[model samples]
Target: MQTVSFLFFNIILPIFIPIIAGYLLQRKFPLNVATLTKIQFYIFIPALLFTTIYQTELNSALLRDLILANLVLFVLLWAVCLICARLMKLDAGKRSAFINSVCFYNSGNYCIPLIQLMYHTPFAFSIQIIVMLIQQLLTNTVGVMNTSSANRSWKGALLENFRMPMTYAVLIALLCRWLSIDVPKPLWTSFELMAQGLVPTALITLGAQLASTHLYLRNFRVLVSNAMRLLVGPLLAAAVCWMWGISGVVAQVMVICAAAPSAVNTVLLAIEYRSDPEFASQTVFLSTLLSALTMPVVIALVQYL
Candidate 1:
């Protein structure tokens, strides 16, 4: 009871109320969700990614293990989504949107903050940062490619993915990290300032997207997508953790992170690529709003183990 209450008041509510505000803001005002999304993708997200990667003191061996773990999870989610899409007989755009809802999660704004609040240590937080970076890279590249391909050719989709400023930002950050290049203090501070605002920016965009969603929210498809994102996602991560022999804190962290909601970026990608943005918005809103209830259960289960 204490855990639930604390998590609700301190962790979940504080993190999620911004989304509600954003949602209300959209309903009241004439905000340009597309422009906000563009600013996020082009300016804020790239800054966050670069700053996160550059700041965290990542360990090579742990990073390698996390890469393998994340890779396996992504592949498994991909296969599961593909089979489910086939079974559902969804059209190309909806199929792509469905795949994204389950496969890509809210690792940056949602998941990272959860980890930070749970484990009172920089080490655990840093590990999650590494995972978040890997997830961000995949979400920006393969995720974009997958969503865009519903409308265009694979070649065009690939080109589109590479063209995103995020791809270049990630590459540049990585290269700088490899060469041990030290960014000037002023420039690094500027990056940090931009990156720090990503959480609210993303949540607000989610709310704005939710404002624009015109789909029937009380349907089998919406329920299933939410179920797959909030429940099946972490279950698959647990299975993969067992398969990979992950245990202790790392296993717990992975499970919790996997349990996060559908990425807000999914909606952005859907809107930008002319995919099923309505469905994506519905999935993201439901999953994020309901994660408040589900995440506590997941945390308790992790503790029990």
Candidate 2:
């Protein structure tokens, strides 16, 4: 009971309050979700990524471990999703959405705040940032290719990734670090302020997006996708961490991030490519709602494990 209460008050409540507020605000006022998402995609998210990557002192070994853990888990989850889709006899459109729903997760808006609330340390937050970076990179490239119908080329997908400011933010931060260049105090202050606002703005934007989404939960495919995302995801993460001999906060963060709901961007991609947008949106909504129950349990287990 104490553990349950702790998880509720500390982990779940703090994170969801802002999300719920955003949802309500959007419902009442009808927010321009596109503009809100643009603010995040163009400004806030990049600033957060830049500051986190620039400030964190990740050693070579730890960096390697972080990269490998994310890549291995991604590949494993992708394979599992494909097998499941095949068994279900889903068509190409449904298969693509199924795979994306299971593999890509909400590492930004949902996860960044959650980790910040739970750990309150740069180290843990930095781990989440790395995970976010890898996720964005993959989601843009592989996810784009997967979603695109014929006549859409891999080159276009790569270009789309290059167009993302998040990619450049990471690159510039790394360059600054390698060159031992200091961000001028004046510039650094602006960056810091943006970074600080990222969590709330992101969560609120997510809420607004959720407010506009339409969900139909009767589909068996939606349930399967959520199960893979909410249940199988963390289990796979834990196994990967164990295989890699990762423990402590790194492993904990890995598990929590793995359990994050489906990424909202998947819905956008689905809409763009006409690859079963309904399924994509449904998975995103249901998985996020269900994660409210599953995430705390995952966090509690990871804390003790």
Candidate 3:
């Protein structure tokens, strides 16, 4: 109970308050969601990724585990999305949104902050960063193909994948690591400063995006989809972690990442793919709002497990 309280007050609350405030402010003074999202996708998130990877010590074991964990979770959620789409008899676009929403968890913005707060160690945070990178790559590459409405060309999708800043950052980081190139202190400091803005800006932008959406309080499909995200997703991840003999902080981070509500990127994917962007946006909004409560409960339950 105390642990849950700490997570809520110390970690979750700090992250969310600014977001909620941003939402309110946005409502009062509207801004462009597309412009903000573009900034985040192109600049802030990638900068953060570069800084984190460049500074961290990497190991093959940790990298393999992170990749495996993300792959397993993505596959599981994709299956769930398919089942849900079938049951719902959704059209192609709606089905795509549903699958993207379920499969692309907010492993970066939400999970990283929560892990950093819970573990209070740079090493643990670095693990979360690596896992986030793996998830980002998978979602941007494979997940994009699954949701795209354009001609399904693997080569095109792969080409588009390189356009993402996160991918470029990872490539640079890997090269730097391989070559044992130490970043100059000034450059490292500049990157760190830029990276520091990623989380808060992301959360605030997310909040603003949510505020822009029209949430249907009585939408049963939306409610159930979010329930699957908050409950079933985490349970599946927990089971996998147990089966894989993962324990301690790694297991906790896995569970939390799984438990996170739909990523804001789901809406972006839906829009790009000519899917039901409205539904996708609503799901993202509601899930994020509800996560304020559900995340604490999930964390509390995991503490006992």
Candidate 4:
């Protein structure tokens, strides 16, 4: 079918090709994925976020609607994750990772690309980027607190989020937009160049991350978390869409954004916070692999909706 081919060639192939390239490079040379991730975290992601939000036509009314929709979806997903975590009787660290796995998603790398290819419009892409902003902010703040050591206070975790440059990048962009400040040509062009690398870098690093991780899991809880992420997540997103009276491209974009696999950043957080990186990595890997099959279904489903 044309739909299948379009999804494959346009969506899956673009991501997988970079991943395969990174995988081969890592296998041959054994890269320092952590250092690469640091580059992305400190420089690339911030640049991408700043450029996108600054240039996009994110008006106040649409912004308010998106904020509400994002808020409702996030709470629902967290609640769903908590219910699953309690039922599984998971321990503290693993429960934190499980809840994070279900809540945080690949909004940046996965959803943005699909949105661009599927609709090829700035409005649709910007909507997905706004969702990415919500996910990124939550992953930095709440995610940090959840994974933190007991001795580390929630205040410490909150401050730790401030250390992330991307957070400030977003704030500055928003301020610039509100103040009607413009990014001059040379700087804006450079920002655009940096933004261009985000997707390819993210996908390639994902491959390297996968290559570095030890991925043999016996725990069924991982599967449960993935189900919550890839299955329940979209349902919750759709519910929010309906609740907010969202339809057409915006609704489809929100639902597709929810269907993204666990955030690659979740693994980074687990490793940094001394949580169960093994479990985090395995969950992300499996969810991502499964999403290769599920994305097409969501894509088609969105069309009918």
Tens digits of per-residue lDDT for model 1, 174-282: 7998899999999999987987677788777766766766656676667888888888888988898888887777878888888998988798889899888878888
Ranking by TM-score: 2, 3, 4, 1
Task: Compose the digit string of candidate 3's lDDT tens values, residues 1-305.
Answer: 65777768877898898788779979999978678777877777777777767767768886677678768877888888788889999888777877777777787667766776677666677777766766777676777887873656677766776777778887898799889999999988888887777777777777787787887888666887898898888999888888777777777777888889888778877777777888888888888888888898888877754
Better of 2 and 3 by TM-score: 2
CA shift at 73, candidate 4, in angstroms? 1.5
lDDT of 4 by residue, 175-270 (tens): 998899988999988887887777778778888877876666577988888888888888888889888988888888989999999998898889
- 129 Cα displacement, candidate 3 (Å): 2.3
Local distance difference test, candidate 4: 0.82
At residue 133, candidate 2 shows an lDDT of: 79
Off by over 4 Å in 2: none
Candidate 1: C-alpha RMSD after superposition: 3.4
Error of 2 at 104 (Å): 0.4
Give the top-scoring candidate (lDDT).
Answer: 2
Q: Comparing 2 and 4 by TM-score, which wins? A: 2
Taken over the whole model, the C-alpha lDDT of each candidate is 0.79, 0.89, 0.78, 0.82
Residue lDDT tens for model 2, 116-184: 888877778889988987898888789988887474677776787788898899889989999999999
Better of 1 and 4 by TM-score: 4
Candidate number with the higher lDDT (2 or 4): 2
Which residue pairs collide in model 1, if any? none
